[model samples]
Target: MNAWSGRQAPSLEDFEEMALAALEGLPAPFRDLAREVTCVVADFAEDEVLEEMQMDSPFELMGLFVGIGMAHDGAAPVTGQMPNQVFLYRRPILDYWAENEDTLSDVITHVLIHEIGHHFGFSDDDMEAIEADAETEH
Candidate 1:
């Protein structure tokens, strides 16, 4: 039998689980900052979101960070402001994975951490270090 046996695409819930696992593997500091952020997994970007981002196709976006970052002013909670959220687009990520050299879990972790890095106003170097640390932990 071929190694690529019958395998179904991960469901939304599966994606969510993978995202959460990525969060759990983060360094302590990043994990603490991410505690208040919600991770949402969707098959693709919503049409409204696509319009707002000026994206012609959902595949153009793999993830998005919504809300103020810690480095910004007035990041504290307001009386009625919605909580911070990180959105992971499953279909696009899967498509990318299908065409890339990375494993599905690696792809999921990269997207999750990249979005969470935005939440912390982290630089690319900072995110890369965090990802490296996460890899060691696993």
Candidate 2:
């Protein structure tokens, strides 16, 4: 078995690294779009985040984005779209890792890319194609 197979809590910095690395693995176009976007990690979803996202519960949101989309072309302040940010809800991630066989880093990466995919307005089909291409490259 691989050395790091089990679920363990990731330090804040560790989570950031894994998330960033995952972003780096995306296609150049997608990676460029992700630039200027900040990534944050939290133990749980905040009340405001929950309300803003309209999440029924903390568990419902494993990640989130709040920012102006590239489509807007910076015509207005983010009051309507907000700054681009990717939020990784740490606790729920750990919970999923514990129950599943995947490593924590992989989970973080998936969430990171998935949220960034939201920024591009990529459909599920687009994401699947991207993911397939990424798998082939890796």
Would you estimate the TM-scores of all the predictions? Answer: 0.92, 0.77
Best by lDDT: 1
For candidate 1, write residues 1-138 as lDDT tens digits: 876687788999988898888888888988987898899999998999999999989999999999877777445776787888999999999999999998888888888889989988888998899888888888
How many clashes in each candidate? Answer: 0, 1
**Model 2's lDDT to the true fold?**
0.76
lDDT agreement with native, every candidate: 0.88, 0.76
Q: For residue 97, what is the lDDT in candidate 1?
A: 99
Model 2 Cα displacement at 19 (Å)? 1.1
Please write out the lDDT profile of model 2 over residues 1-138, one tens digit for every residue. Answer: 777877456777777777778778777776776787888888788998889878887887888877765655542444465578889988888888889997776677677777877777778787777776655555
How does residue 9 of candidate 2 score in lDDT?
67
